[model samples]
Target: MSEALALFASSWFFVAALLAVLSDAFLPLVPSGTLVIAATLHLSDTHTSPFLLGIGVALASFSGDLLLLKFARRGAAWAQRRLERKPGAASAAAHLLAALETKRARTIVVARFVPGGRTVLDLAVGTTDRPPRRFLRWSAVSSAVWATYIVGLGFLNEHTFDTTWLSFAVSCLAATAISAVIARVVQRQRRLARETEAVEPVTVS
Candidate 1:
């Protein structure tokens, strides 16, 4: 993997980072962190500063996210049509859309770490009345922080970073598990709120 990234870094850093970000936006399990780490490792190995690699990764990631947001806004109707073909999927889809449309600010910020939430958040923000500059600012900052952490991990583990994909895999698993627990907690809270609303009495004229 290290060798592959080293070869890619020579001539394909931009493309690789762009695809990594796009994949990360749609597929949480894709290990985008690993890609950034690998890129930084390769750069460090070649006597190049990791900062350049980090900047490249961050820019590519931010660009990919913005593109996804644009697509989500313009293609939502088509996406809905496709999603409607699956059983029991339309209801959940509708619920997610409603949540995005109604809770753009909070949802976009919090959904940064949640699996499958990145694209949703991007789409939500794109479709809403929020300022594009604000969304871009927040998303870029978050992407930079995320890229830095992963790249820093590679730097710290430079000795065995390439040899032990297991370590990174374990970290990804841990993050996913924690995110799942958080999602469950959030869902429970939403359910409680709905229940409370359901039981509220109607006013008489």
Candidate 2:
């Protein structure tokens, strides 16, 4: 196990983290965070610098997010161009654009932690008139915090467990479990809001 850590610590660990985070943006369900935690767990024993690893993860994450938004922006432009030719399409697009601009920062920050959320929010934001500069600023903060959270989890698990692999497994499982619970809570809240709207009484003029 120590020999394996030595090899990974010397090479591939950073590469794996970067690629994993990059792919996770497009593929939403990819286990990028898990990969990071596993790598951290292995390297912790090897005495690798945590700061450097965190930076790699943060930069990779930010790049992936930027790419997603750019792709979304281009796609939105194409759709708008095509839709411009159709009746009422511009009007519909305008409505969506207005809604998206309203909560650009809040959306980006909140969605950063949720699975598959950043993808949807980034795509939506890209379709709006919000400046990329604004998104980038907020994304920098989100990426840093997220990288810290994920890496810190690995350290926590490492300290708690005797076996390195056990630390990896438990960290991944705990993360998954926590995310699942958060998802359920968000889902329930949305459902209740919809139900409340459905049962609201309408006043006649």
Best by lDDT, which number?
A: 2
Structural similarity to truth (TM-score) of each candidate: 0.66, 0.78
Positional deviation of residue 45's Cα in model 2 after best superposition, in angstroms: 5.1
lDDT of candidate 2 vs native?
Answer: 0.73
| Residue-wise C-alpha lDDT for candidate 2, range 98-189, written one tens digit per residue | 43467656555656677876665565567776788977887888888888888889988998999988999999988888778866765565
Worst 10 residues of 2 by lDDT: 91-100
Report the error of model 1 at residue 116, Å.
0.6
Q: Compared with the true structure, what per-residue lDDT tens digits does model 1 show for residues 1-205?
A: 9976766665475456547866777555676665665555556456667676667667766876888777666886754554455553454344454665666455545566556556556655555455678667767876776566656666666654455465456555555576688677656756775688689698999
Clashing pairs in 2: none
Q: Give the range where candidate 1 is weakest over 10 consecutive residues by summed lDDT.
A: 88-97
Residue pairs clashing in model 1 are: none
